[model samples]
Target: MTITVFTNARLLDLQGGTLTAPSAVLVEGDRISGIGATDGFPEGAKVIDLAGKTLMPGLIDCHFHVVAYSLDLWANAIAPDSLAGLRAAKVMSGLLDAGFTTIRDLGGADLGLVRGVEEGLIDGPDLVICGKGLSMTGGHTDLRQRTDVRPRCPWLAPRQHGRSG
Candidate 1:
């Protein structure tokens, strides 16, 4: 197993509501095996001194719209599918940089994005997606305006009747 030892770091204990003094964290492969002083760590283990920086657990976002790239519904609806996916990728990277390790997306994120994370194609958090957004005929997820009479988006396939417009 690949071992990494992180030393000289202040560990944050959320449950106990305390910040520990300089400590050592031992990681084996992808999992954290232990947290304490560096003694007894295996030889040849890679070591990184944190220089008195704080190390805390990654955060979680329970409510995130991965495809809602913009606040304006119309703008998001009009954006191309590829463009929206690209924008979501950027959002994911930003969230990861901010220490978010997991995100639950309520809408618009597809299986592709989820797979992207699992396969390490995307540098982002673990994603829990709903496949697609659901909405009532005229509920919050409905992007239609009262005065508008066009289909929701152009990239979408034709309706059941094969009507393109």
Candidate 2:
């Protein structure tokens, strides 16, 4: 496995509410193998110096709408599926950069996005999704503006068997 060592980091312990002294974290492939002083680094492991930076656990967002690219509901509703997927990818990448490693998308995200994340096609956090949210005809999931009277987006509405209500 590819082994990497991160040194000179102050490990943050949120539960204990403390920061450790300068330490080294050993990572083997995708998993953390060890954490302690520099003496435990495996031979030939690639080393990264944190330079006293804090190494903390990744954060989690319990609720998110990954497919809603913007606050403009009408715009989102009108966006093509390909465009929306691309936008979601960008948002997911930003979340990862901001140290959020896990996110639960309560609405709008689909199985395709989940597969993309799992297969590393998208640079994103571990996404937990419920496919889509339930709403009444004039309720929250309806993205139509008050003045514009258009049929609800078929993709946004939950399907029942072979039909959409």
Q: TM-scores across all candidates?
A: 0.81, 0.78
Clash pairs, model 1 backbone: none
Flag regions of model 1 displaced more than 4 Å. 146-165
* lDDT tens digits, residue span 88-108, model 1: 999999999999999999888
Provide the overall lDDT of each model, using Cα atoms, as 2-decimal numbers: 0.87, 0.89
Which candidate number has the best TM-score?
A: 1
- Going through the candidates in the order shown, the clash numbers are 0, 0
* Stretches of candidate 2 exceeding 4 Å from the true structure: 136-139, 144-165
Minimum summed lDDT over a 10-residue window in model 1 is located at 154-163
- Candidate 2, clashing residue pairs? none
Question: Candidate 2's residue-wise lDDT over 49-115, tens digit each?
Answer: 9999998779999999898898987788789999999999999999999999999999889999989
- Model 1 error, position 65 (Å): 0.8
lDDT of 1 at 124: 90
